[model samples]
Target: MTHPPSAHDAPWWRHAVIYQVYPRSFADATGDGVGDLPGITSRLPYLAGLGVDAVWISPFYRSPMADAGYDVADYRDVDPVFGTLEDADALLQRAHDLGIRVIVDLVPNHTSDEHAWFEQALAAAPGSAERERYVFRDGRGDGSEPPNNWKSIFGGIAWTRVIEPDGTPGQWYLHLFDSKQPDLNWRNPEVVEEFHDILRFWLDRGVDGFRVDVAHSLVKDAALPDWEARAVMAGADDEPVVHGDLGPMWDQEEVHEIYRGWREVLDSYNPEGDPQRDRILCAEAWLPTQERTMAYVRPDEMHQAFNFHYLQAPWRAADQQRIVETSLEAAEAVGAPTTWVLSNHDVVRHASRLGLPVGQPRPNGIAAGDPQPNAVLGLRRARAATAMMLALPGSAYLYNGEELGLPDHTALPAHVRADPAFHRTQGEETGRDGCRVPMPWVAGEPSFGFGAPDDVDTWLPQPLLYGSLSADRQEGVAGSTLELYRTLLRLRREHDLGVGGLEWLTALEGMPLPEGVVAFTNAREDGPVVTVLTNFGEVPVVLPEGREVLVASGRLHRDGDGRRTLHQDCTVWLG
Candidate 1:
């Protein structure tokens, strides 16, 4: 028998399956061809049906859309393009009524250059109090070059030289990302106070939590330093190695202090109140190691941090096992639960990323000139990988459209690309537009039913083949990726797999398994033991004798000797 979720016992967030909703691409209810708060509110019933415990909405704040909503122009208001403040309240209320919590993005590291404070700083004289809210420093040479040699994550120099009101060259401002996004000076008390107020604004309106964007990047090293050669050449043009000694820009020690303060603010919401209603905070931190990642989720700090290392691990049994072990160990040390994620709006979709060679660094975007991804192989592996992730003893995050097994649209026309990386790299790096295409909802409809009316044009064009992968096409279809996800979620909750203890099972009794297979058992105190087996090799492996099969990612073959066989890139849950 399955027990109802009780937060007073373990809290909803500890083992919740949170679905990430990229507001622009999730669903467009208005005829405007853009997703809005009302659009998301209308879809709460769907998410509730999907069995997700919460919804983590991406940034929908007022912005210039320079970095696709990461550059915030205003913190307290919703973007007019997405919807108004009233719509946000409605989304929150509807989600709560459906027993799903809501977590909105909180981007504190930077703000859009068009923001009132940024505009005032530009008009004010150098070294003025207005400029102190942001990182402003004098150039190294004749004040023409940048102060330091730091490079922006997008491309080009991290510093942008500012022209004085008197028409003379002045100090430069720092922007870790697009130039339009000026990095805030976290050292400033006013900046800290402003974010605190912003957090309360949403918390007061009944938001469940905040997904802190670039959580590790809030505090920079006091002394700016140049990037070392090894660090500069770490990844592709668009992929910056923010992990491992990225000096003066990311993973600074002071960032922990900031989150500790934010933790106090979150705790204030549930003072002597029900633990079930306690507001939570999750970090989008990209630390170097699992141990380092756990620092953000210490008992007194944030509740969870994204497991990027697990997502980037190669599709090998050993690699996956090592990451899982380290992640669980580190999270356990802090008394916090681990968060497993496959894909998000920023990176190439997992379907395409998994199809590439195992060890090579994956690019953020794939261009038309690039080699094509093997969609069939990618989808098979993705389905198996997600099954394994959901059975693990922690929370799992599902990006929008992953349930439909959507691959990145690599053939997108160059003219429609909007990612700043594409513009900065001059098309050398296609950017992340391929993964951010509007999600398909209905088959054989214009824009694939991403928006209302056949004539409405989505913000980003949908691929011609999207109709086949539409949610409408996959719904209720056996063996479909969507159905597989729904089944796995149902089983996960029924067996308490999300909060159960995990034990690696290499061989049953005396039977030895294949070399490239991963097997583990999700053993709950009271529920039946669910053994998960995944095959990464070419040849099919025989399933252990006498074990009853519960579910499988692909078709299974039965041997005459009464043994069940699992095909390559397939996963199964057995009792």
Candidate 2:
């Protein structure tokens, strides 16, 4: 897709560079040991200067914090721990003033057990309208067994039996995630209409768009049949990538129907008179295939879906190339731009992931006694991988601290962990708290300047390594990851890489890339050509003649002929 001559001439989201902010760990302004809205607002200048086009803040709505704000109790109000409605309004105003858009997280699939609606459902008798708003069903045989044999993504059975107000055993409600997060019944008209109103409430508050949480989950199979015999998506090592159905719990066909209505709600805000002011929706879909993932971004539905396929790809040239090709092809067919992401709050940082031995199972949580990744190799590969990611022909998402080359706090004490994944699994599987440690803004300040100097403690302890890698220490330091990102983002926009067409180096007749190299050229119809190459092999590869180097992820070696040689785990942008 060709970019319009000016940002105002096209939808900003089409080629935007978004940054994901995990709030509780971003900054703490209230000195309460937790990151708050005012804290995020205070950091808007840092984001604006970072050159990102928008920020997708994780859920900060009123909640019991059972699942780190994912179990939203009130969709319209900000959690007191974070801030209030006035603080949210101020954040929106300040971010917009800085030319940065805001995309708030929306958890529509479930509501907290403490939510007013859920409380009402608990008090009302079974089969009442209040109970109908959720997936409350009578259990089979003495009402003791779960309604279905569905497993929660967290752990255990997906259904949770609730005790009635009269102290009698009642119906079981579907949770899909943590027990405290009751899944909403989308089939109920009140549930559907309530979300429609929730969308308008935020849109009217001036949010540019929403990052829909569990976009594929609002609707499930009507039958809710047992899934033990159904087909499941397997990993790359598995023989066939995808076959049969995705079971009754995920990627149901009815989800698209729900999103189409949301599109109408967003479109209502963007009349012909204000096309550039269009509101967009992004899906956090973790499907098994490009075909399934692309369905969420169809023209009349959501605008973009997370590319988990790319995020989960092994650090191999062939694998990366295949995913990029398929993703681009699939999105192009549906008139949507592909989204690229390397790190986020839910998984181990890509820096640490790349450092681990190839093909090892990704760890949910790492402690002191566990196998450790190679910090040096991990950061090197991470920088190279990021350069290649930013140069791809679409939007790129940067996690909060990946810019600082931050690795996971693998040795964090178990007692301080808060991720529901950890508690739900009873410590057998560590949770995502390793990667959610608070960012270090200063090298010497308490909590690394996360809050006031006297705020000695944070919600999650910072790793000792954060001292040297702090943003203050990295600033103005040449070759630092932070500086590399600033330069990469600047040139990406300057060359219009996001809106350019991508062609594999091998696709160009007579140009065969090295065996272990992934190379591509991106050029807009009216913009200069830019080439990105990454060396994943052990041997150095000689560069082609007469290409000017714009940026390099690491130091390059020069041969006798003065030609640049890209070393292993190195990436370079040539123009």
Candidate 3:
């Protein structure tokens, strides 16, 4: 499964503008109140027009609806809620036709208890081959004692007992997530073989690649030691301990074998030798520095690991620039490509994260005790964020509805929320469902056509930005946010800044940024490149030097000092 040296020379993941879509909430072709593969196909052209190179559809595989679709019942089949295999095939064909690559979410860490493999493991006698499918051990002081001092990623003990038909206390199995999702025993030869075959199945079906869920969790600390690395258990707010890193043994000469072997499978699919016909492996590694993150992207491993520094970066202009510069320097130091994500299904929106108000909050999204965002300021800030996202180096991840300035609004009742970790932990840390709301394509209509075009009531009932911000309403508006996004994307494609080939120059400051302005440049091997200056302060600020002004949010004009001054909350590019 090897591609030609020339065709596979450059990594496709390097320059792509990737769009992440929660398929079930994207669009519903069957009017079944959920988005499906057919729905995705119908929307393919829209994504293509937006200029994204790849689409990462989150877990549409067969699942039990626990943790949304992360708990897989069958890795090979598309969940009926998301349509059948035929629908997926149609989507892949349509996207490829539009020149958009497709990548599906792969959760190899664990499978649903309902899966045949797990069920078999529960039924088998202790120490049997079937029992070995998962980490099944006796309770209490027996070999089971959880194998370590680990706590579940969801909170509480990581071990739970399984029962046989005869009421015997079957051995307990390890589950870093839900009690129903038993951890696969990577220590077992059979488990690794199972996943390798799963990889081949999709590659053969023509998927461009995969976003490996918990890529580092495929294997755990073989020693199964007690709590290590503090208590990273169950995310922030500190729950109990669970899951461990894939150690030297897991990174074992064997893990590389998995990726190298998988690459072979991907190249085999590109029989015609298309230059861009290849697989992309993205790992969700949120390491502190670029060097740590790049390890996942080097040659044979993940093509792109998650970059979280920007998301965690302070709103202060200098801080944000430093994060980007540090990351760029680190990647270059190791010669690895990076990926960028502004919003995802897990975190709060940029506007919310920045504490800005997001256009009058709906009564539904405002939790009983939460403060409502300053609606107007929120939208303005998000638009500005969009500008920054488009201009960044490497692949840009656009979550659904972000193009339309959509505000996060899923207001889950304390009881109905489904995220396992959120419930298991004490902060009642709102899990992802808050961000995976239905895409409101129609405005003001019943249920906003998110559920069914004809019905107003949807599983996720909130006002659809139809008349105000719906696709139908903003499709042709020249200056609408969606249009701005489209324009920005088109402009991004016209420059190598969106691509990965250019050298990125650090905006080293010899002096503090002039009161309200943030300035930086993208250096190119060909010549001096564009200098991007942005003003977020309350007053207009002037650059100390003069250059050709390319684009401006406020007025792009020269100052008395022969420098360019931009209005507050505006941007200017020197070409």
Candidate 4:
């Protein structure tokens, strides 16, 4: 059967190259050593020049910052650390003027305990309207024990007992993350109505779309059954437990109904005659299978869902190829473009993660006492992997510092680390602070020129190695990671590769390729066909005959017969 058209046939986000800006680290315009909305506005021209079609700003909402702004206190205003509502408006307008769409992060799974509703819940008696908005339960036995055996994703009991204002022990509330962030009761109609209004609030301010955080976690089973430990639920030491039957806490079937309601809100914003103005929703669901993930991107639900399976796949040709095929097929079935992401704010940077032992668990963070990463080998593989991602058939996402080939500061001092996971795991996990360090802009400048004043200290300390990877140092330099990105993005637009269909060249007749290599062609009906190949093995491989070279990750060697040879861990583009 033929695929159906997506929500908007020619929407820009369908095949867009989106750049994610983790606001706290992007730029420090306020001189407070924290990046803000104004700072991001100042850099729109740079993003436009980088050839990205859109920007997804991480949460800048008014927050206590207990979980680095993911624990939002007020959904309508910006945090003091990120600037005011006017600043956010100016940034959105500036981005639109530059032909770049803006997508803001929407955290719907929970709210900061300081939120008015949560505060009211604390003051009100149990079974009151305020308490009904959250998941409040009575403790079993002596009212001191937790209601169930549920463990927090952050490494403790999910339930926290609250003391009544009368100075007696009280009912317990649930927080899947940190205690400061309480899970919302999606079963409450008021919670549903509130978020619906929140959507309209942002869309009215000219936001093109939203990136829904924890999209698979809004709903829970009504019965709140006990979690049964299964082998599939036992994840690796470093990775989060994302798969398996996580009872009542994740991946409930009722979550889709909520997205369908959200889709209606997004559809209402489309002007009668302009499909280009349609607002979109992208889900950050970490489901077990691609088929389940695609369910979030169906026509009446979200516009897209991130393909984490592909991102978490090992750096092997066979594994990568299988994930690509599965992801494409799943998206095609629902008529949604696949979204490929390599790194983001939550995980360790892929550059360093790929350098670790192949079969071992990729840790969320590495401590000073742990084995260090091989920077040289990691950067090379990261560059090659980026080239391959850009040549694929769907939209691609670039994290803030990936263009500079930045490796995680794996040896960050334990005392200075801010990620909640670090404290929750008692420094054993190291947390995601390494990946969230501020971006480097200038060499030899204090804080690497992240702030306006050279002497300003960043919230997170920058390593000495950042000097060599600063954007100012890499700009205009041949073969620099920054230059490579600019070149690839420019080529992608000029050749229409982002909107083209993909075909595996290795499956074609008379194709010459070695094992542990991936080869594919981006084909357009009226444009030139582009071939992309990557060598993941130790040995070199001969390139296809008579193809014009477009670009390559590294220098290509020529044999006596004029055949081009791709070296190990290299990718090349040809037409």
Candidate 5:
């Protein structure tokens, strides 16, 4: 029905890029000031034109709107606010028609309290089957304490009292996120069966695959020891005692058992290397160590997971390079491919993170108190980061407005925000809302290029800088960051950037590794091995030797026989 390109023409994973669209703010077609499935369907052509291989839609499933759709009350039906099931079918079909695959989000860790199953269990009598659906325990028998002392990531205690079906007043249940989302008792066989059915419902829906949310939290310690009572005594700050263990037991052998079962099921849907219908299972996990991170990507666990080390690392080439190398090494050791990510819904935008002023009170881009050290070397830094990301040997994920050089804190107010983590950590640390504000489409619109120009207000306020920070305005200007993204993506596909044999070569301090400049070469048998040099500094950096420039941040340079000069932040390609 569609005519983009045959599946065989392009390998499912090779030479392909994924573009993430946050459904709530992509576009508001209904004029209700919120985006929906129809709004996303209407924007299909634009995404296809952008030359991405797939679209990963953040959860649009039915829920109480807690955590922005992650708390699912129903798996088979679409949220009315987003659209009907028919609209979902249409959206998937339209994306496929444009040679773009559609990947939906799946959250199996917990369920909304409003779900019929949870409600039934909440009312069932003690010792009933329904009561077993969640982690229910008898509370403070006579003079006893809670099952465990695990503190909630949001703040205080993780346990909430819920009356038993027997009308007992002292029963409690565990919830990791909110009381609104109660954690499921995976120890129960029926609970596992119900979730497996949930997975199959989507698998049968013609969707390309899924991005599994919080895959590791499904299993917990059955002992349920009160964490605070343990000898570990992690209680050091104003906060409650931290959980004591994070060893193999922390992952629970049962966790691997569950994932291996899911992998068997995914295999039934699409066997390995099946191009026409590939079933991908990417996970979102956060752990402190590399060994812990690997548990999520074993051969039978997740196909890939986002690399967060870089996202949290301090902005420095040495720091970033080590993170990148370590991630790649760990993935290879596990015999699984890696997914490179620089930005996501949960982190500050790279531009804001790179260029924020220190000790300044500037709202928007104003110099508030004093400027924090953001990457003052703007355009060049952006170009270098892009080259580094794209040249890596794996799938690359991109956020919506990153290509347009969209700056953060443009106009998002402190109020009208929804991230609990940000609100919880205010003053001490900020959450990721600054980067999630509405996109600037046209510079002329009073709504700052996001909502309709004639409309009184947009869903998210159109920041005042909308006039200058827009994709439309930058599209007309040569060498704009927006243009650079388009061109670089094209070159990636046309020139085969990371396809064949390639090796990384580094120059140490004593060996002419010019200050703030990094040079490396890719070996190719059929053609000239490409040599790339990047400059993250402000001034032009001189090259080592025998290097010719092909592409720069703002302009392209030529060898002119032997010596090469690269402007700051720009990258030069040579063959």
Candidate 6:
């Protein structure tokens, strides 16, 4: 997965702009009020128009609808709710025909409680091979207590005691997530062999790659030692805990061996002798430090890990600058490209997030009664932040609807929420359903054109304000968020910004620039130089001379002398 130094030799993912589609919320072609693979196929044109190089579809595997498909009941088949396996094949073909690669989400850490293996484990006696496939263990103390002090990532105890087939309280199984998802025993030889076959099954179906879900959780401390007693984090996107402070259940050392095996499976596909043809494995590893993050992207392991450090950084000038510098440096150390992202299905959208007063702790979810963010200011900063993110030197990921400046459905009611985090925490946490609402494609249409025009149903309710921000309303509109994204993506490709070299313009020929302005220049070998300037302060500032304005998040103000001034919360690209 090494990215060649020269842009010509680099793998497509090194500079690709990949878009994520949460299938259940992407589109509803079946009119079942839920999205499906066929819906994604029908929307390929929209993605092509959005200018992303690839599409990363979230889990649509056979499941019981617990944790929204993260709990896999079958690895080799598509869930009926998301259409059939045939529909998935059609999506792959259509995306490739449009010059787009498809990266399917792979959940290997755990399986649904109803999965065949788990059911078999329930029927088998304790200490049997069937039960050994999962993390099943005897209860502690009086056989009523959990095996360890660990808490589930969603909430509650990490271990769920299962009733034996003989009708007695039996072994407790580990489920770092919801009780419905039982963690696999990766150390088991049979479990390892099963995942290898799963990888080959999808690769044979022509998927370009996989976004490994919970990539760091496959392996755990063999000792199964009790962790320090601590409260479970409300949501999964909390800031990374340092290695020494981390619990034994996450980011274990043995995980690297598993990925190294998966890498071999990917390399086997490059029969054309071109490393670029090898399928990619992008890890969803929320690790401690930059160095630990880089380890996942080394040549023998994953091609990229989500740059969560950048995603979680505060919307401050100094913090963003430092994160960008450290992210680039850390990835460079391993000869891998940095993968930048703003918002995803797991966290609050950056629009509403950055709109909050600076330095306020990011909430798990924003409900109808929660203090709201200023929509105008939020969209402005979201656009500016996205522009800056695209100008950086690495691959970038765009969650669906982000190009439309969509904010969280902050007013969504608790009754309609389906995220496991929300229910597990007894509604104290708002959960991620707000960020997973069906996208609004057409203005003034039923379900905002998410389904048939007459169909008023959606899996999750939409907000009334979605009408004005629908894709149809923003397309072709000047200075609209959708158009700005199209422009930014276009310029990024034309300037080779994804594979370019970046350096901070800390000072022009040793002269300092304005405070609260983060500026940098990106130049690829044998490519044009593009400068990006973002103003995060309250004041406007003049741009450097001899650079022509290419695009901006907002309108540039003109001073009395006719010089263009970059205003607050604006980001501009100069050529």
The lDDT leader among the candidates is: 6
Off by over 4 Å in 2: 1-10, 229-244, 273-275, 452-455, 507-512
Candidate 1 has its poorest 10 consecutive residues by lDDT at 229-238
Q: Which stretches of candidate 6 lie over 4 Å from their true place?
A: 1-6, 229-244, 452-456, 508-511, 544-546
In candidate 5, where is summed lDDT lowest over 10 consecutive residues? 229-238
* lDDT tens digits by residue: candidate 3, 369-448: 57756555666666666676566666778888878777666355766555676677653455656566778776766445
Per-residue C-alpha lDDT of model 2 across residues 98-140, encoded as one tens digit per residue: 9999999999999999999999999999999999999988998
Shift of residue 411 alpha carbon in model 5, Å: 5.9
Steric clash pairs (candidate 6): none
Per residue, candidate 4 scores C-alpha lDDT tens digits across 349-460 of: 8889878777677677887888888888888888999999998867889999999999999878877889887898787667789999999998977788888466667888
Sequence-dependent TM-score of model 3: 0.86
RMSD in angstroms, all models? 2.9, 2.7, 5.4, 2.4, 6.0, 2.3
By TM-score, is 1 or 6 better?
6
Model 1, clash count? Answer: 0
**Model 2 clash tally?**
0
Q: Could you give me the TM-score of model 6 versus the true structure? A: 0.96
Estimate candidate 6's RMSD in Å. 2.3
Q: Is candidate 3 or candidate 5 better by lDDT?
A: 3
The estimated TM-scores of all candidates read 0.95, 0.95, 0.86, 0.96, 0.85, 0.96
The deviation in Å at residue 277 for candidate 2 is 1.3
Q: Between candidates 2 and 4, which one is better according to lDDT?
A: 2
lDDT over C-alpha atoms for residue 401 of model 2: 93
Q: Distance from true position, residue 143, model 5, in Å?
A: 7.7
lDDT of each: 0.86, 0.86, 0.67, 0.85, 0.64, 0.87
- Backbone collision tally, model 6: 0
